[model samples]
Target: MSAESKPLSGLRVLVPRGGTWGELVSKALREQGASTVIAPLVDFGHTSEEDKLVDALHRLEAGDFQWMTATSATVVDVLAHHQAVIPKHTEVAVVGEATLQAFEAAGYEVARTPQDGDNTTEGLLKVWPEIETDEVLKVLTLRSDVAKPVLTEGLISRGHDVTQVVAFRTVGVPASVHIREDVQSGRINALLIASPAIAREVAKQFPDIPENTIVACVGPHTHEAAIDSGVKHTAEHVESDMKHALIETVESVIDQSDMLD
Candidate 1:
């Protein structure tokens, strides 16, 4: 498509996370005529509880747990790094499309994903009881160091035996000087907030953002987190679509901005 015919033409958008997921989002944005800056705000590292994580993986391979939960793509990366295997008897569950895509890419067969498009822990929990026939199951819930125990706690409250393991620790990455300057000066037209951690990094790195710049968050929870973290956004002026459809969400916001202009 020609630049003038594109919806996001002349717009610059920031993609927070790196690796396979980042590349996919960046490619989608570029196709819509948006120039993307892939400055990853967070990186994953080995968890401090190495022994516990190893034991959990060993038991997972042994098919001790009836179900395994992966909340993020980073969890799938940790599993791939450990060369872990999901036995035939154990079912795999995930929260969002990104996690589902990561599992599929890693050659892991997922047995469950949110069907209602909620794509959050609450969404997964909502369908868990209906999909799972077993009354008492041993669930292995893998999560990041900073992740809340909402899934684990919900499972336990539902009378399931749960073993929650810290898969990896989230580490913050500093943005380059040029990227920081562009953001502060409003050279970048928009910023994408995929997670609360990335939102926190945005707040820490760029304390003062230009009011003209648009900040698009992937979901409702993320939008709340961004505002709570003092990340300036355009939500006040526009009714934005809250979905994990990152490219579509960006286009929706840009369209709103056009109408306002």
Candidate 2:
């Protein structure tokens, strides 16, 4: 493959997740001439366990909560299902601008957001001190089942009454026949994994991708998951955002593949 020929001209890319973030990555790969296949390895849905979240909202209405944290846009979607509006008194803290936009679209305002950095638990905690905790400080965390307890533990360490509510659950989608065929036939040249859950599901479905297949991840958490799942060759941190990370990873892989050929 020459520079004129390009590295990803005939490459097939597999996107194991489906969401606004995943769509962004897919679009970028298509623009680069990669045959993008969306297998949607994970599905997110609101669970029937809303009583705890409803009770938390009641507490927020009673002015018991000081801050509410939403780690992902899916969290905002699940939260909106229970409460029509988030209490104006309770400060909203989120991880990404997309999450903040979702909150705002749902008629809530975000007080703090991690614009820079890895957008991980540690990044959110660095801005935690700015929040006042003179009162009981109810910290309601709307998250998925696969979410880590790091944020909750950090808030507790800061003397806040942290209540983590499982707003949504991540269900693994079995790999489709087409995806299986693509993998078995060695058509997929790269795998773009954005979430840890997706990485786990991919590992389960295609236990051994072709040795030439490139493994690219969005952030440190996903990278750790990929490594744990036995994905040997991984891309470095491109950006905290999923779309940019995928784009950069694809470009890098294309460059490397071109060099090798």
Candidate 3:
């Protein structure tokens, strides 16, 4: 437990992701002595193209792919739902801390998480593993239908065999009425946006956020998404990595907000 006199003592933060993601953010906030509101604003649904996903999973289990990749935990949820199995020989690469944690929690060992610090396709491409000359790696990428094809295209450009499959659908889940009202009324001091999808939901669900509310994003891409969604959160709210980065960024935001006061 954190000391009650921590920097974030009086803050009321809104964690807009659910499942383990929400739990992680909430726990981190609590550890910083901040109160958290776990109001999930988005949820996953079956992949739009289920048949294709199943076929890809079958190929993956048959060892037809050399490397399998997961960009989000929802992909793992899809695997759990279908009881999909990966051949022991097929290496797994995951992006993002949450996805990596979820992947490990599912009892799978990860082979790579791109050496580049950024958690984007560019990062994966920049540090795409070097394989032996005799082996042409066939890669399976689990993705959301709306996610950009940067990773697939990048892998293809590098001469790797890439099969990109949509494993889940991202859709908005309405926040509880009181949660929405609190954000609108400026009662929640800070809002944490872990993904572009969550940024879109926060923008849509709370179109008129109070100026004092700090809307923070997990990284550059999510920050860009917030901007694209007309989410008016200050440009200073992007953290590039995990728990420590998030906590540091949140504390900075709080300190700056105090300076303004």
Candidate 4:
């Protein structure tokens, strides 16, 4: 497609949080005629409580838990790295489509995911009772170090026995000097906030965002985080394909700007 036909043409979008996902999103943005700067603002690492993780994984593989829950794809990576196995008897529950895809890619089956537009931790909690329908269930909830205990607490409130484990730690990555300068100087047209952590980093790193610049988030939950972090001019969507949703948000903002011009 020609640049004139592309909605994101002449726009420079910053994609935070690197890895396979970043590369794919960057590639799609390029195809849509947007210049992408892949500056990772957050990353995942090993958790401090290794012994607890090991024991949890052992019990998980031993079929001690009737349901295993994953909130992020990073949790799936951590499980795969430790060669954690989910026995056939134990069902798997996930929050987002990305996490579900990660589990399927890692040879694990997903038993439940939020079908509604809300794909946050609370969304999963909302549908927990309907999914289980039992008096009580043994659930193994895995999450990042910075993740909130909403899922665990919700399951417990529902009369389920839950073991919440910090599968990995979320670490912040500083943007390069050039990237920071471009952002502050308004050279970058928009910023992509993939997670709440990235939103916090963006708010901390660039307190004064340019008036012309836009902030697009992957989902409603991330959008809420961005707004809570004091990010202005932010947009978000709830869709199965997060990349497409973000791209659509950018396109919408650009279209709106064009109309005003």
Model 1 poorest 10 in a row by lDDT:
252-261
Cα-based TM-score, every candidate: 0.78, 0.70, 0.78, 0.72
Q: Candidate 4 local accuracy as lDDT?
A: 0.73
lDDT tens digits, residue span 107-132, model 1: 87988766655666777787776335
With a 3 Å backbone cut-off (N, CA, C), the pairs that clash in candidate 2 are none
Per-candidate Cα RMSD to the true structure, in Å, reads 6.0, 7.3, 6.5, 7.3
Q: What is the C-alpha lDDT profile of model 3 across 80-103, one tens digit per residue?
A: 889998888998876666677778
Compared with the true structure, the alpha-carbon lDDT of candidate 2 equals: 0.66
lDDT (10s digit) by residue, model 2, range 171-245? 888988878878867787777776777778778888767766666765567778877987555344233243353
Candidate 1 vs candidate 4, lDDT winner = 1
Q: Which structure among the candidates has the greatest lDDT? A: 1
Error of 1 at 55 (Å): 1.3
For candidate 1, the per-residue lDDT at 6 reads 70
Please give the ranking of all candidate structures by TM-score, highest first, separated by commas: 3, 1, 4, 2
The models' CA-based lDDT, in order, is: 0.76, 0.66, 0.72, 0.73
